[model samples]
Target: MRRVVLRGFSTEGGPRPDRTALLSLGLVVLFAPLAALSLLPLLWPLRLAGVPLSLGYTVWACSAGLYGLRPVQLALARLLWPVRRPTAAERERLDLVWSRVLRRAAVSERRFRIWVVDLADVNAHCVGRDLICVTTGALAELGDRELAGVLAHELGHHLRMHTAAAAFLVWVLLPLQALALLGSGLALPFARLGRHLRRTERGFGARRWALIAAGRLEAGLRLAFAAPGVVAFAVKNAAGREAEYQVDAYAVDLGFGAELLSALRWFEACAAPAAVAPLVPGPRRARHAAAREARPTHPPLERRMAAIIARLDAAPAAVPPQGRGRGRSESSRTLLP
Candidate 1:
């Protein structure tokens, strides 16, 4: 068995970028120009203020979380997403768990920030490289050890730079994603308009037909151009499944395998009844059309649990979390305040 190191920690040299991280970055490079098109409007105001700008630099800056703009990133996440700074009670609970996690990982508390996402589901996620968002439900629902496992899993993503690559990737694709959203929003309205015009014109107008043909041709061409990037994104998401397993391994290495395993079982218990509960009568396809077992970025639950169990079973008895206490290594504390 490979000996575990708490300080650096990982599959290899101290959680460097893996294949998933690189692929996310590769997609960013491929889509940078197209994404730049979406940022022009936002930058126009700055240009009016005589700020020097280049599309290349602006694209890079945004993808890199605008470099030194951590405050802006946090603010945008609060405004646009279901996240916020933790309240006193939430922070008290959150920090207690986080201190243990940080203590185990041998990392400074100041390096990472945690946020509370006001959600009911027992869940959490890593955003970019520095932010960890935990759902309020998770705080209320999980025990301290269970919550630590979740945090450790997310911290693994940061250690490997997975979140860094992913956040920037999403930002890079924002323009295309926004366009896709816009098209869907306009689709029904345009269809209604077309039907209305068809009814008024008694169904045959050369100009209308010409307009429809032009629109279809333009849409087809755009789709054709977008196909490659879409394929790349799918590949990146596929890579994300492997990352889930890798971080699971990280949690295990930190002696939180049992804790993480318990957390997973807790989730399974909560979700079991819902998975099998009766739904409205419908065709099999229709009933399952909207249901999903897991996200594209996660491995199946059974597989993740199995992986964690195997790691825990194989872990050496001398490992801190296995048979030893948190004080197994005094070195972990040497770096802490």
Candidate 2:
């Protein structure tokens, strides 16, 4: 159980993005089609929202749907498409927990299911109504209070329908992922020629040569046509971090802010010893990550903790003191992580 503190505490900061971020994000408008086009065929089997169409329409509509429903579909895909089946006991326990939480959250049980995956990773997330997966490691590492906090955070995603919001982003990025792959392949060859051009321009004092080099760089970028893809990928990731803050706010509103904060801290501690693994590169990963700024789905842990703290300060809660307490309080049962 979470130990309630009567003292007030708040998150360190709030969400804000500058003009450059906004400008960068604008690129998504153009790139969404590319991602939608690429990812549509893969998702056609789901037939979500009853918008089945001719093959041509499938591509067009899917590109459009990427903006609206792809996230939800992706979430469903992640939740249900397990590489390994869950143990029966774990499945039953997870179902019970999910059923109870859904009732409390006033969500339809039919709309979602929470499944415990036996993976050892300390992570838990919801992809769609059909599947919510919590790694066994995460459950084992956290106390019941902390676990509830994590669940509440995930539940916040369901309540706010963040999957749909995420789909809007995916529509723009599916194409970018492809472009990134192409761009990475071109990186070495282009960089070598680009360096020679720059050196020749400096040594020979050639204005025309410099201009030509600049044009080549521009042409190379255009040929690669990676800007829209790159920018879309970056902003899509930025939006995901923002979504994390919004979900944290949801936990606070539900009176589990402290628990969530504690859970986050514990998760960070557990993850600290592990070397930071590259996300996409090499045989197991993609390579473009080295060439560009890396944007990720979650906010920085310190920043996230700070945001939670700031929220706590702005609106204090009367948490009942633990252990030496008088009569048992109902609120104690609903401890935040």
Residue-by-residue lDDT tens digits, candidate 1, 1-337: 3332222245333446877788888878887777676556556677788875685455556446473367765765675458888999788878887998888887888988998877666678766568888877777766666678888888888888887787677666666655544454545455555566555653557757855765575566556545544655666667677678778888888877777776676676554333432211111211110112555566567677666766676442322321112322233221111
lDDT of 2 by residue, 1-337 (tens): 2222221212222222323234334545566556656555445565564555355446654554443353555444544434234578666655655564555455666765565555555667665334456777655555554555667677766555554445444545655566655655656565666667766655456654665776676567655656665566556556556666777776766666776776666555445343343332122111010111222655556666667777787432433222101122233332322
The per-model lDDT (C-alpha) reads: 0.63, 0.52
TM-score, each model?
0.67, 0.59
The local distance difference test score of model 2 is 0.52
> Which runs in model 1 stand beyond 4 Å of their true positions?
1-15, 33-68, 178-222, 225-229, 272-292, 314-337
RMSD of each: 10.0, 10.5
What stretches of model 2 exceed 4 Å from their correct place? 1-30, 33-60, 63-85, 183-219, 222-224, 273-295, 313-337
The candidate maximizing TM-score is 1
Worst ten in a row by lDDT for model 1: 282-291
True-structure lDDT of candidate 1? 0.63
